[model samples]
Target: MGMIGKYARLTPGELQQILGDPALGHRLVEAMGEDEEDGRRLDVDKAWHAMSFFLDRLGFPVEVVFGEQEVAGAPDWGYGPPRYLPPAQVRVAAEGLARIDGATLTGAASRQELFEAGIYPDSIWTRDEDALAYVWAHYDSLVAFMTTAALAGDAVVTWIS
Candidate 1:
């Protein structure tokens, strides 16, 4: 409900057209991108930050490729201040994220790791069983988006609503 985001893998030129004509941008977003509409109601930025925390815990440094601020204009997608990661960069981050073991991402250990990072409140984090479910939901959702982008040689992109 607060600052939600959807992602799409798009070519630079196709993206250019979307940003160039605001009238058709919203339509394009629906058709061209994947929406995390069914997942837990977590802010995209917070989820991304948590992912960053997870990466750091493993002694790996990767770029936060989502919800960034870039100097670009949106066409039909509405206002400006959108950011996008090129296909090459998306592929790189996708690889890093994909490196996380499936079990590690959904297991108790990963939940504890995130809790230790102070990303969630102590009260809620104490409920590891519940917390882990939500955590895994977001993790899987992100992986799906990033992996899709990487496979299609498309950029990872988002715009402010």
Candidate 2:
């Protein structure tokens, strides 16, 4: 299956399950290249990639979550948001989200702008307007979840499989 990016407002208990599992525990460390523990990978939703690329253009390196490994390395499971995020990181990201204008994002002008910026991958470009609109639709909720997690000083975990 193609990768799908997703995140949730994780509770501390949910985070514990992830941190307690060795496969998941050291994921953030691995992603950030803090060590060579041998188990961590990360991928955002393909749609989210465009947003990340856009952010990179603005010089804001935002790595919201990190992990492409199965949750706990389970054979048939998915990735979960790693329990990581300094309060400052969360604050910065939440503040950055204020720049998202939902109406403007889904409008024709934004589509043209994104296309011009060359941020979209073929997965989105192939479907034309529909996929683009779909990304925006989900983005609204994605930002909301991230914002909520930030407000509570919690991490927004994701399971992209």
Candidate 3:
């Protein structure tokens, strides 16, 4: 057993069970270095890799949720105002959101700016709907990746949104 594997731990019957797909299971198994008696081998890097894998399988959506004009096009989902915006809570909420593999913007702005040449939010924690507009304007690839990890068996993304 490798040192990492020995130190790592697993709580599920099999990594495949959590991933909900056989192909993902195969990938995780291959990613693992070796078996360990402690069985505690979960880590962020592995989870991130899995998220990227699943996003690749899902295929990111072409639409941007925040676009109000004809140029931005439609998306699979819509964005709206959140109930509240607190301090130090900007990182995840301000970044972006993706149900599967697309981006969404919920505030006053359209979804076009996130990927547009000069489109990015001044900050995520801003209470101004206009300032928060960027979150809706662009599809969050990172969120899509993280969501996949959270959906995976026994895995959770506690940090950021």
Candidate 4:
């Protein structure tokens, strides 16, 4: 199986509950599996690496891509424990992401540039043209996800699984 980037929107109450007991983070993410209809969840698939690299190169803060708050004791199935951003931070991230025009993101870097920059899943960078297209599509989805979370004043949890 491949690593997938996942995000879950948390209401203030849910955020508090998880913060008060870090273990709740695991339960929350696991429960998300059973509720696939929830609009609060997003899966960016394997595009996370290229997206993060592009966002970082574009001057967006790391918090927007990887989050700032680490949920201590949360299980790390692969990459690491789930990380979170508070509602205020989510709004900030959403604003930053909104400023990234499609033309700019798509034209900012070539596959070789990205590969040399050390974007993850290194093999994809030299494989085919579809790699960048795949990253761009997932990035659009991520922007939409963050925008909705920000509008709802919801916290966001992100992890690799």
* Top candidate by TM-score: 4
Per-residue accuracy of model 4 over 1-161 as CA lDDT, tens digit each: 58888889999899989888888777876787835366688888888888777676677774655779887767774688889999999999999888886556766578898789777777788997888888878888888999999999999999888
Show how many residue pairs clash in every candidate, following the order shown: 4, 4, 13, 0
| Alpha-carbon lDDT of model 3 | 0.27
lDDT of 3 by residue, 61-127 (tens): 3111111112112121112211111111212332333333232223223324322423222222333
- Give the poorly placed runs of model 3, Cα more than 4 Å off: 1-104, 110-139
Q: Residues 2-83, candidate 1, lDDT per residue (tens digit)?
A: 3444455566676567556644445665663354463211234335445555555565544443444352544524335456
Instruction: Report per-prediction Cα RMSD to one decimal.
Output: 5.3, 9.2, 17.7, 1.8
What ranking emerges by lDDT with the best candidate at the front? 4, 1, 2, 3
The TM-score between candidate 2 and the true structure equals: 0.56
Candidate 2 ranges with C-alpha deviation above 4 Å: 12-17, 23-46, 65-88, 102-123
Error of 3 at 52 (Å): 22
Q: All models: lDDT? A: 0.56, 0.52, 0.27, 0.82
* Model 1 weakest lDDT span, ten residues long: 38-47
Error of 4 at 144 (Å): 0.6
**2-95 per-residue lDDT for model 2 (tens digits):** 6555444444564565656645544533344522122122234567655555445555545653422234443332444333444456667677
Q: What is the lDDT of residue 27 in candidate 4?
A: 82
